[model samples]
Target: MKKIKIYLDYKCFPIWIYNDKGELIGNDLPKELADDKQADEVFVKIQNIYDNLFINDLIEFKYIGFSSEIDREGYLKMIDDAVKLLKIKLGDLYVIEEKIEV
Candidate 1:
């Protein structure tokens, strides 16, 4: 049996989009904020879009890692686990597998 491997790539941003005075608002930092000379003084907790999704438990397989790539065996395993855990059809997902000479 091939072992399943899954890699998670995270795009994270600050959790708080507002300024200290509670004026500016948004999920991302505005240009005004970026232009601020004191921008370095601002600090906020960061979060990933994946954090908003409740599928963490489903994607958190035993072979999951924080790398950008996974081997063929690992990818297959992840697909199988995802289908079984999410109770979804394999056809619903899009996957491309290729062979590398290296």
Candidate 2:
């Protein structure tokens, strides 16, 4: 299992996640606002379990509106595009990308 390394700009509001191979897996908003409190805790758990996610294995992350304002729908779409890019570039090794402003 390969864990992905990802950096989240507190300013961006979508959850960003990566695998060990440095690939974007999944990004989306939380189920609700109240869930924000538990975002870090849940993320830690996710990391603990998926510390090393294999290639092709989806690793989803969220960019909550915590540190800054971000486009919810756009971020999600970015995640989708990132995943596709990873599949194409890494194929089944690893995928990772930097957060960009759209």
Which candidate ranks first by lDDT, i.e. highest? 2
Residue 72 of model 1 has an lDDT of 40
Q: Estimate each model's TM-score.
A: 0.20, 0.30
lDDT of 1 by residue, 1-102 (tens): 111112222343432233445443443334434543332222221123233322356556232333444544554454444334322322323231222111
After TM-score superposition, the amount by which residue 82's alpha carbon in candidate 2 deviates from its true location, in angstroms, is: 1.1
Return the TM-score for candidate 1, rounded to 2 decimals.
0.20
Model 1, global lDDT: 0.32
| Candidate 2 per-residue C-alpha lDDT over 54-84 given as tens digits, one digit per residue, 9 for 90 to 100 | 2332675443242223544544454556445
Displacement of residue 28 (Cα, Å) in model 1 is: 0.8
| Residue 56 miss distance in model 1 (angstroms) | 2.0
Q: Distance (Å) between predicted and true CA of 74, model 1?
A: 29
Reference-based lDDT, residue 49, model 1: 21
